[model samples]
Target chain A: MSAAGRTVRPVSIASFAQSQNVRKDNERNEAEGLQPVIAEVFANVGITKDDVDFICSGSTDYLIGGPFSFVMALDAVGVWPPRAESHVEMDGAWALYEAWVLFQEGEIDAALVYAFGRSSLGDLNEILTLQLDPYYEAPLWPDIVSLNALQARAMIDAGKATEADFAAIASRSRRDALSNPKAQVRHDVAPDVLLEDDYVVAPLRRHALPPITDGAAAIVLAAGDKALQWSERPVWITGFDHRMETHSLGARDLTVSPSTAKAAEVAGVADGNVDIAEIHAPFAHQELIIAEALGLDDSVAVNPSGGPLAANPLMSAGLIRIGEAASRIRAGQADRAVAHATSGPCLQQNLVCVLEGA
Target chain B: MAERCAVIGVGQTHHKAKREDVSIAGLVREAAKMALADADLTWSDIDAVVIGKAPDMFEGNMMPEIYLAPALGAVGKPMFRVHTAGSVGGSTAIVAAHLISSGIHKRVLTVAYEKQSDSDAMWALSVPQPFAAPLLAGAGGYFAPHIRAYMRRSGAPDHIGRMVAVKDRKNAMRNPYAHLHLADIDMKMVEESMMLWDPLRYLEACPSSDGAAAMVLAAEDAVSGHYPPAWVHGMAMRSEPTMFAGRDQINPQAGRDCSADVYAQAGVTDPRAQFDCAEVYVPFSWYEPMWLENLGFCGQGDGWKLTEAGATAFDGDIPWNASGGVLSSNPIGASGMLRFLEVAMQVRGQAGEHQVDGAKLALGQAYGGGSQFFSMWVVGSAKP
Candidate 1:
């Protein structure tokens, strides 16, 4: 009846898989695009649909241009007599959070979490404009890039960062993304050369913008004995939490992310020394903002898997960060890692996951 | 293994085709405020908030939860958004309950709403996606064929569907909040109604309603003064692919698995004899029987027989949808939670005019997305 001394249901990411990121994936529907990724994750975990106790997914119908798009994606899983499942409209990271909650109850042993988005299917910038207040800001049609530009300008004006710093982040991301097959944006241009390029939005350059992509990612979570039996090395989630800020851009303090700072604290991000971090900051300047909010130092390797700047696939981008961080633990690359995901414009909501090798 | 959760408060808006008088924030707040009042609490008592809706396209506002946070009194608190298609309402409630059962939060407020009047649901649903077969009509078009499949499999009489339509409408007369209250509803009238989809007459289908449903869930200690809390005996959600080779759209496996899991937890070996009443999401009339089998109220291929014998009627041994259900009132996103809230209302003896007589135990169910996604819960008067 009480949480004190309650059995901590340790759940681990058993297997993870993601699709190849591309500028435009016109050949396959969301289900077809996700089928191979789901199969690969299951194959890696050596399990079938029958072995899974629950299924949860993260997606937004806005990305695919329809309502109930998640319904059609069910064709990929081929549910017959139905299976225990749930979903989050935010991102795959939150879907994994839901599955973790169920696992904590000790009722379900294993769950599959997957998410897909076709950011290139529509005018993503224009579509994202709708995320603003419909009555106030949306009428102005402030696209994501323009909004980020405002933030970037504020950071510059506040003397917290410089345009060169934003360019450097983009340069390093592209250089790092060269190693990621799933990354859609990869170029070896130097930061100085990037600064020479014309600005897409005053202080922000085109290279700083994430490539619109079509992609899918899936992860399998197993709890307690299932986690121990699934693999030799397991990536255990130590702490997970998410928080949201007010929606109106005018109502927020555009310079700082209090939500991310609070979420990181609640998730015990400072309780242990983090070796690696994967932060979801689609815009280059926001990376600087979140890295400081998370209190990550230069010693902590950030976005070794290239992060969202490499392939920002809307809803799936955040989940991919968690998967990327867990993959490092499974590969014996790090003892502890932190993965973060953001939703809504100007990072209105943030989720933090701290993973440790077990 | 987990802390027990209870539904301390339930609230919903009076469903209608259009609620143009209020803004989106006002629509959701109406339900949230009611739920808060029911729990004898204020906005400050809530620890977290979870909201769900079908799609942002329905309101032409992407992730409206961001804008709705203040209206839901979620400022400076954790807020989460869930979209599991039509079953989002049920899933949203489940997530809130989990917060309590996890012992992380004592009080969680969950809300689901859809203002369909903002846009055409049919067009929103039919938006063409790259590299996909275009759906000619809306969801009804996609589901009609499956209903036909159920008809063919069960060998059910054509009139059976009409009977369910008439029965639910008559029941709606008792539900003051139901969207479609046909005072003169009858079998003949339903049978003669225009066919929106084959086997789904206009009267048999759920209306495109603008409304919202909200619930306040609390942990055991948090419900000290809340009397007659509808204890959450069991909760489960299941899903499968929309389609695959030999996948049965009629009587989806996810719905069956979800029901089995919930009933097992609730200690109900036989839902028919154990449950005094049920509030199930049956957007179309024929689904009443289809879901009867899926939810284990009857054996496979025998669900229609329960309808034929009037066993699912309000006065029957196992009453189903005594408040007219989704067929009579459906705010797509909130329809699932409406079923859940209705079940809670029954156990709490708070269902006013539409109260099922002495309903001690009840089942609530909802399914979405090609019938692949399903969420169900069992509620009872006694604390678990």
Candidate 2:
């Protein structure tokens, strides 16, 4: 604990909504794509924009090839009377953290958090390359898959895992996706079949990669009394924290996630037994790494909503993990869960949010 | 209620058109180190970091905070990045305050910066959208027409903008850190400058500068009297749909709402009488008068009177931008935080040459994205 977390106010997820994950969505623009999901999320909770004291979003200009993409996405909510709103360049999970911070301030009763990514709009691989170290790494244009492969290779060299371990994780994640209605890539595949898949980079295989998804998601959060009033079964967020590592790939121990472990500890993820966890690992091998960082035993079910392997929507995928974990608690499927979000190359930055059912 | 938060220290890099002397990481570290030094703290003492900037395209790096974390000594520490257009700088500070005020962190470090020389801001902002109207002109071009409308509606004289240009440039002469210190600057020079966007002469507009602004925020209990802290009385942000009918771009409702929200929390019933000074974003000279009206410093359509009457100068009653505001130095992303940092400087009695004498209260505001986004804060010398 940072000493300041002692007096943290309790917050809860009142509602969650998402657009169907898809490989292409040429039919709608970013705002248009987000409109229905925003309305549905608010409607699902029986609350409107007026109920939200603040609004925060996560998105990137690279997705749309322009700056201030969230500016346009606000139209979906009809931000009238100039509501309090902000946007993050990272993931919606971060935006949720901002909202959570404000909610803890005890001024605002509730907040709206949303994120949208049109990965299909441009070259996802090329756009992501821009996130690299411009001077030393981006010039090389090592795509994200290759970077993940390097991490996987490091993991393999450390005798921590193998290519088969990555395949088994992917096979299980996709098999679980069969029940998720919004999943973009859902199918029953044997681990043996996945092991035969061709390598996209070196140690990374096609089955280990997440589908390129264009999707949007939203989460409505309420604080204190508002939480009790908004939803019949609000999933209380008991602990939340995010930690970042160094930027240089060579500077860090690629096989270990000290950042995720620190975030999980700060978030109090291990205070009680985790019933389930929705981890945001865009790549399968990374999931094993983060799960270890969280110190979750096999007894704790992971990614009940298929996780990012089912429908990885860049900016929204991380937020969806929180929603997925919360939804399980809301539905009485689980009592305690930890939702994780990762960013940067090889999951250098991570967020862990511990949720509980009352 | 939220815990009281205060600005214990503030620091800013010298604004310049191109800071080739330092890399982007070095540029921000300069401000961060200075802020830490001012606060008598170290990297290990800070609990977290919250950074904000405009578009990543400005530096051609996506979410540069990932790389900046090491420079800020944020590894193994909670870190957040805020990007809300130009208002990001102000909002970044607000988010940091929340970390303290919400009892999440006792000490938080926040920063905003822009290395415009790394990439052409004009081209970065003007990137074409597939389904929307092309932004033919950069920010100035988009805002020039709004400036024209304010002139037509307020019936303000053309010289109002020129006078503002002269006054701000003159103020820059006193600010050693200001990018444009035109010692010989005058209305004639402003008038003779090329009209980049009609009604917005080159001299009347903000220069593209590279700079960073950083601040150390602490919970009131942590302020052990090591340094004067600017108590954050209130902080707020508001954003509206970027494009819509009946949107008053001249005096945006977001700006009005943002100021009203912050002022109300800070108990500022009358802005002109309540605050000792302000640091407002005025990229183009014309925005000075427009924001004066929007911020409730004066009645609608009467803002030009303030600028025209020399009421907004360093020697004026409610002196604004005494450290030479965005009009003199604009590191696009850091411009908003400079407004915030300058206000803190004023209230802390540290704004060297341009300090508002015996300043008790101060206000800072920033707006961005076609005037649809707004962030503002009120600071005071005394503990709130």
C-alpha RMSD over true interface residues, each candidate: 1.9, 1.1
Cα lDDT tens digits, model 1, B1-384, are 389899988888988999988888889999998888899999999989999988889889988887888889887677888988888888889888998898778899999998999888888878776566877688889889998999999999898888899889888999998999899998888878898889788998889999999999999898832448999999888777764776678877667778888988899999999999999989989999999998888888898999989999989999899999999988899999999999999999999888988998999998887777788899999977
How big an interface RMSD has model 2?
Answer: 1.1
Q: What tier of docking accuracy does candidate 2 attain?
A: high
- The 10-residue segment of model 2 chain B with minimum total lDDT is B220-229
Interface DockQ per candidate: 0.60, 0.84
> Scored by CA lDDT, what does every candidate get?
0.87, 0.91
DockQ of 2: 0.84
lDDT of each residue in A65-91, candidate 1, tens digit only: 777778778667765656776778878
**How high is the DockQ of candidate 1?**
0.60
Best by TM-score: 2
lDDT of 2: 0.91
Model 2, C-alpha of A80: deviation from truth (Å): 0.6
